[model samples]
Target: MTRLPASCSFTQALVNVINVLSGIGLLTTPYAVKEGGWMSLTLLIIFGVVACYTDILLKRCLESSPGLHTYPDIGQAAFGVAGRFIVAVTLYAELYAACVEYVIIMSDNTSTIFPNTSIHIGGIYLNAHQIFSIIGILIVLPTVWLRDLIGGVGASILVVLCLLWVGAVDQVGFHRAGTTLNLANLPIYVGIYSFFYAGHKVIPDIYSSMKEPSLFPLVLILSFIFCWFICTGAAISGFLIFGDSIESQKHANKICSLQIAVCTVVIITISKYALTLTPIASGLEELVPSKWSRSYGVSILIRTALTISTLVVAMTVPFFAFLMALAGSLLTMLITIIFPCACYLSILGGKLTNLQMGVCIFIAIVGFLIACDGTYSALIR
Candidate 1:
């Protein structure tokens, strides 16, 4: 076997953690907090801890099973074919949901930038949704086909850009509204915070890439601390600047002078995320080999499909609150809450503590209910 690179450090591993979490969700953190309040911060802390603990557990499992290559392999080693199937299903579902959400966000933002230019298809005029979807597919195809790709550095660059954008927005928002945080909004804040901190599944992939897998626990602790601090700072600053009046602002119109800065950051950040998700859609093709055997062709097709579907939904749907809620409450829960513990217990074997089992079942149950509730709410409202 080829030896792993000695230069790989914990910081590099942490970069992977940052890369995975620094997707479109970062942009939505402020919106989620606006609804949840300070409770969002509390949720971040709680979920962050759970995420870290789960990471440690995953690292342990990876260490114990030397031959386990992918996550599905680990599942198989732990719980036979049934376990593999469960993990695969959950992983696919999570990725599918993530892709859908990304497409939706991109379409919405694009429409905001270009309100005119409609394409007439069937009996209806093609709107921003159709346009953006086509655009999204066109953009995502190329990046998906390359094997052994390393976009972590690119993602880091985007993260820096996003930070700068947040700084600019915070400055303008703060100047206009002053530096007061509304304590009454804690619950909404916690819910939103949870949304941002929900990228735990990527931890093992990060750990495996590290020079020393054993240090992942420490890496996770420090990384999450930094991420939480940054998120909290951004959230407080954004809310202080825009308050609850953000939606009323004209599309592509920055709410304050700093909004121009925010938009610049948003465009770069979104581009990076769109690029990152391309690989996920490509991976899906592996499951359906008959339809997607050609990497280049499938990648292009998936991206195109996603982009178009997202743009259509965005143009037709005036609001994204329901979609975001569904993504957060259901898909996020599957990846963050349910899968981790389930994989851990299966790998470890034997019996789990009442507390451990309880938490696992609770997350699954709650996630299912939330998904159902959100779906129903979306249909009704």
Candidate 2:
């Protein structure tokens, strides 16, 4: 059995969980909740329960497979190369698409935060979006190539403070904007709810990093509780803060754009860029032959190419809402609800009780239905 140094404490584990799970996904919660009206709350709770349940299931998966270092490893162990392919394609594609959207979102907010700016250098003018995009690339490039964690208690503390600031900022917006409480929007936002709570991809990494891996269940539970509170706070406060005026801000309040840029949006885009790119990069590394894996020049070239490709997409068809909705309903539903339950059943080899079987089928069905409608809704808009 191979064991990495158990350097992460429970507190560090908790903060890391919060940081990973809470990413830019929290930024969309308020607007999502507002979209489905009060009906969204009940859906959010339902999705939260499902998310927590599957998290435990995935943990059970790790316990069953000792040598698995990544989620694709788990998939391969469960169902061979096809399983691994499904995970790699779905997981990496989801993360890749998500990172691209963040690029657009970052640039969008950057323009708003620093709008109408034109800098002249060598008699050439640069737009604010261009300036910000270049800054984003420069800031993210080196970080993406480093293997050490950019996410930790240190970054997570900032995340928590920023979230609290968002809540407080929204509260002030509520008082100033005088948003009326209305719960009459259509209630088919289960996709968004599932997206908000989906954090299964990070579980295996966190589980491996722990001093006492057995205590991961506790961390998972506690982290879920912390995340749930912040999400609910953001959603409820934002409902009253932006209410009917959500269309103007789009993100849900006066400071939404600013918060999105400074808090976790760009940081997440930068930090997770490498994280999301890992599976693909690993594949590329393999193609380059074993001896070249340690070549710094090759690694930098790969990272730079990946970053520029994502930037290209971001600049092209930058449909922010569509991307989030797609990720939430289509991609997140699979990782959080469908795949875990499927893998669990496969591992048990049909030895489940009637209740166990029923629960699994039900959750899968719920996720499927939500993905369908959510995709449709996103496409139409």
Candidate 3:
């Protein structure tokens, strides 16, 4: 029953896109490339295009179905129970993925603060597992306690600050000689880079918040263009400055002085993203109620549980590259491929021309293949 304000403008809508896309992915891009190589960059461009196509399709669906609010709503309208299930699965997957990613980032940061304190048990050394768990709890509790959109914005601002800190460090390395791009490294880096730039799932929210939804396409186009340029620059800058030393950049060990500063910034950014994910988890919990049904206590308990779980994973695994890849694969499929094409098909009601349907189908298929490839690679690795 909560109604959005009518006063929200097109600029505000664009800002939302910026906020959602500007997260740990930006920081992780360099590391992802370390794993996959320069092919990551090509994938980044490809995914960016896919993301935009999906965004437009999602916007079109929203305009066509005025009553459809959330992603789930659009799914339901398009494919009935099956669609609803797909959306439900997608949303929860995203929530859990976000949680895991955030926790891992946080734990990594914590390791920097307490380097010698490896594992703690009952007055004995535990293991990396225990340390991760502890770090996760610490980060989750504080974040869960401040669960709200406003809090999310605060978290995002922290991320922005971290990016700024990285910028400063990059400046320090500016005087250092740059490296040449290895043409052989393009594929993997492109893929990883695309994942970093991808952020189209929330387009409907952006448009809905706008005073003029009609202007949304233009706004999205411009905003994504900006994001693309920024990401490309960041990738080139990090690669040129650090070269094969990019892996070391993950721990920020190469620049020890900037380590704490960079990690703190990254953690803050990711924490904000985790905060944004809480609502999705809460919504999922609503689908199956237990003794805690309709109880305010249940809400608190569920939120707390999710936060703690996320923190534990973050602390323990601390595999930033893996989590980013997983998130990229799953979310890219849902948002960039499936949802948009489904929206178009549903809205058109099979009445579209061959060319129109062909385009939608082609995009959907391409997205599906990329997602599948990414997911397969992630799991086996």
lDDT of 3 by residue, 60-152 (tens): 777676797666778888888888788767766765776676555555554555556665458888554457456556645655644454323
TM-score of 1: 0.75
| lDDT tens digits by residue: candidate 1, 98-146 | 5566555555566566768688777877777567656765565444434
Give the candidate number with the greatest TM-score: 2
- Rank ordering of all candidates by TM-score, starting from the highest: 2, 3, 1
Whichever of 1 and 2 has more TM-score, that candidate is 2
Candidate 2 lDDT over 117-140, as tens digits, reads 779999988787667766777777
**Which lDDT value does model 2 have at 159?**
44
Task: Tell me model 1's lDDT, rounded to 2 decimals.
Answer: 0.57
The alpha-carbon lDDT assigned to residue 341 of candidate 1 equals 67
Better of 1 and 3 by lDDT: 3
Instruction: Say which candidate scores most in lDDT.
Output: 2
User: Residue 115 in candidate 3 has what lDDT?
Assistant: 59
